[model samples]
Target chain A: MPTPEAWAESFTEATNGDAEIGAHGKYYSCSYMLDMQERKLIVDMHRGRVENINLDVQPLDAYEFALRAPADTWRGMGEPVPKPMYHGIWAAAFRKNLSMEGDLLVLMQNLRCFTRQIEILRETGVPV
Target chain B: MPANGRFSPVTGRYVTIDLEDPDLGGEYKVFFLENGEGRPLVCQHTAGCHNHQWRGLLEDPDITRSHRVIAYDLPRHGKSDPPNDREWWKEEYRLTADFFTKFVVALCDALELEDPIFMGSSFGGNVALQLAWRYPDRFGAVIPVEAADYSPGFFLDWWQHPHANAAQVCASGTWDLMAPQSPDQERWKTWFYYTQGSEAFRGDLSFYSVDHDLRDKLEEIDGERCPVIMMTGTYDYLTTPEMTAATAARIKGAEFIEMQDIGHFPMSENYPVFKGYLEQALQRIEERIGATVSGQR
Candidate 1:
């Protein structure tokens, strides 16, 4: 697995460079956390661009929503071609051990952009 | 005419049917697309979607030559409006298995179609199973794609939440229902269809995830009479292959075919891939029903 710092840098760069997100993510401003058990990442976006990715997640670090899962599950989801159940949050949460917490309306609001970003994890791979 | 400017042979028409139930009974002007002749193959699109999902199947010369494809929009979906005289807006549109089955039977009666083969995906698929159980003699066969005995959890508030953009949420929420390998253009087209029916998606799921439970009633369906040919895509998390296979196993003489590399909205997301499995299912039905695709009324 890649280090947290390295993974954050690559994810930020890749998310910023994504053309699909750029085309449709003008209003996709939100901050969400990915809790992979071993580590957590809080990604902040501003007008479709990556504002920051915080590796050191404090207890009170607020985010609109959080997707929590085991390290292995994250690895499965980050595969270039994920298996049937690990394809998306709905799939993973329904079939696997992925847990979603916090305000879901915000997640649903930016679902299109967030879903595309999850696909980007396929290219970048998971740090855990 | 230019290649892209050419018009399709498929024709869409409206048929109004009066549902006779004292409670839910009302006039419904349903919209449908049809072409070709022979055995009638009536199709139902997934929840929060329209008959256009069957665009490829309706136009395919292979299927249409031997089968008349009739893809219809359910009431409150696509071009079909809600009950003409009822105060539908006053009450929540929670679809029930009873009303859905009656509506389809009434539609067939109005069109004077004889023993049409019914095929549907997702919610439509669930209703197919219900039809098989309730009205075995009404349909020649039921092709329930990407369905299970009891599909719960999808009937959520997000589709029509007051604070959310129901269109984007419903569309993007179903994004993963298609396999990542499906063509982007077709997947986007399916996504586009979902955007148009956000109002009815959740209501339709009332039957899909809640009222359409056939868990204990699977044995009630006489597969030999109705010939249930269930097909489910491997990538569909909502109705996984295992769930569909289990549901099929309970029905005596029912067959379950697992479709590879496709997802829930098979005909919409990737019709070419879906067509291969569809042909196999149709062949199985023909073998079971002891009738050829060219069999006439």
Candidate 2:
């Protein structure tokens, strides 16, 4: 079973030097959740930087939103070249394959950052 | 701290020149900006909009320190005055490759800029292609964003609507195709288009949608002396990635890059993503120049 914990290092590798993320201002800070299968990923972002990513932890809840989808859907979204509706989180939501709950503001605020984060999963090959 | 808070105010100046075509020939004031120092980097704005598109490049320390970024407002656009003979709105306004080519070379000569790197977006992109084809050895490199040989159906009802409100409607419709995520940028772009001289957008479209076509002329371009890079944003509905890719394929040594999650107006819509692509393209140009120098040695 693959956990979000196993995906953190790879996610960091894909995002750190990305031009878009680096240009965002210092006030851009947020946290969110990615729920697939039985695990929940709590990703912490500060000043447009990915600070921490924890998995399967519920002791302290600091997440602004949670994006839930079938594990198979996550796998489809994880494909190197995702098909039309499977390419991005917004697209997945639009197709009704993924449901977003809580703080829609934060999710939309950091949409590009989060979108690129998941796309990086394709590069990481973490087996979803 | 210029009028726009995001970037520095570029120094604006005007140069008067005579047009080649007698029917359209007259003294016209061409407005351009000169910012920073080093090798010249000439930027052309998209149709309708002014040189404000290059605000980011004008302020970027990395780009400005090594290159003098010069952006000009096309005739009947921004601060550039109209030709003495005709009114831009009342008469049929059209742009031809011949006139565009002459204007670019003249601008260079007037400013004493030699072999500057040419960078443009949309209609500006099409003009870049024309420049490359006309003067193969005149430019250092050609970087055209969202460039395509032809953009069919870009103006479906562009000038067909009621004259009074047509410009607003056209400008408003484009707002959706710009950066969907960024509101400030959208406002800026819409305002840029809205404030254009009536029918001026359509005038430039005459080139983008009608006159400009280099599909058969790509062979004439000397890619070795002037490296051509066609960059297309993924979200550009008018000039899609497929179109740019096809154009690049025809040119033997041209490079095509698809910018991710970006739209038609990259510099205005998604600066970071667009800048990333620009830097990468510039790096590639540097490598090619170095290799050429070494090869000749």
Candidate 3:
């Protein structure tokens, strides 16, 4: 497992460097959380670029939506070659205990870009 | 035929037909792509999608050589429009199983097809089951791909929610439905098709995730007569192989084929891989139909 600081750096760099997001995420501004059982992260984006990545998330931290799952689930998603059902949040949620909490409408609004951002986890890897 | 250009055997046409549903008799100008020359093989797309999902099957020279493949856009999908005579926008679009089944039958009837083989994926798959149950004597065989007896939890508001770009939400939302092993080009093409059908996607699911249920109706379907052959991809979490197998178990003579390394939209996402399983399915259907032949059926 990578350190939280290391994961944050890779995730931010990967997200910012993504071409698909850059092309299609003109309005993909939103705040979302990745609630891995062992750690939590709030990633804020503005026009497809990562505005900030809060590695040290507080209980008071806010996000429009959050993807919550066990560490194993996050680990599977973080893998470069995730097995079937762990390839995406929807896949994980349907077959595993991964849950999408909070305002899902906002999540759906930015679904296209957010989906790509999550895929970058494959390269960045999870902190847990 | 010309420099830097190639010609495809597949061609497109439009046909107008009256809906056969008892309560709805509206007319529809349906569009379809066709090729080949044998017993009719009618293809249906998944919910919110069009007949283009069968592009791979439509142009396959082997299948086209023996079977006349016809992939049609169920009204309001692709080139098919909504009820032409009614104020369609006045009412919310929620497809009923009765309407969907009748529509397919009417389309086939309009085309004057004889003993057609119906193959559909996702919601199209569910309707294949419905077609088998309701009109056993009509179709030669029904191949329901990535389907089960009951598939709920998909008919949601997110597809057409006002707060989101329905196109992106619908497209990206269903992104994971494909196996990661599929080529990015093919998967993106499927995604592009999805973007064009957000308006009809949720309504189509009305039949798929809501009205289509065959848990108790399976026995009523004489699979030996109509030859019901079901196939589900392993990566399809919505209708897993386990669910499909369980559904097949209850159907007296129906056969289930579990496709590996595929997902919900097999024909669209990964056609080459799906083609092998489809060939096996086609062979099984032929044997079953041959066994149950009564008179020229």
Q: Find the candidate with the highest TM-score and give its number.
A: 1
lDDT of 3 by residue, B1-297 (tens): 799999998999999987755545598999999998877789999999898899999999878767788999999999998978888888788899899999999988899888889999998888998998999888999999988999988999999998789999999999999988889999999999999999999988888888888887877888888888899987898998999999888887999999988899999999999999998887887776653222221
TM-score, chain B, each candidate: 0.97, 0.89, 0.96
Predicted complexes: DockQ each: 0.87, 0.02, 0.82
Query: Higher lDDT: candidate 2 or 3?
Result: 3
Model 3 sits at an interface RMSD, in angstroms, of 0.9
Worst 10 residues of 2 chain A by lDDT: A107-116
Which one wins on DockQ?
A: 1
lDDT of 2 by residue, B1-297 (tens): 557667444688889887776435567899998777766788988887788777777878777766788999888788887787665456666777788777887777778776678899998898888888888677888898888878755544434345234554445445434534434654466455554644567777888888888878877777667888899876676777888999878876889988877677888776767888998888788787642222110
Ranking, TM-score, top scorer first:
1, 3, 2
lDDT for position A62 in model 2: 75
lDDT of candidate 2 over A33-119, digit per residue (tens): 878765667888888677888765676877898889887778777777655445556556644378889886565555545655666
State residue B100's C-alpha deviation in candidate 1, in Å.
Answer: 0.5
Worst 10 residues of 2 chain B by lDDT: B288-297
Model 1 over residues B1-297: C-alpha lDDT tens digits? 787797898999999999977546799999999987888999999998999999999999998887888999999999999999999889888888989999999988888888799999999899899999999999999999998899999889889998888999999999999998899999999999989999899989988888888888988889988999999999999999999999999998899999988899999999999999999998888787767557453
Q: What does the lDDT read for residue B235 in candidate 2?
A: 60
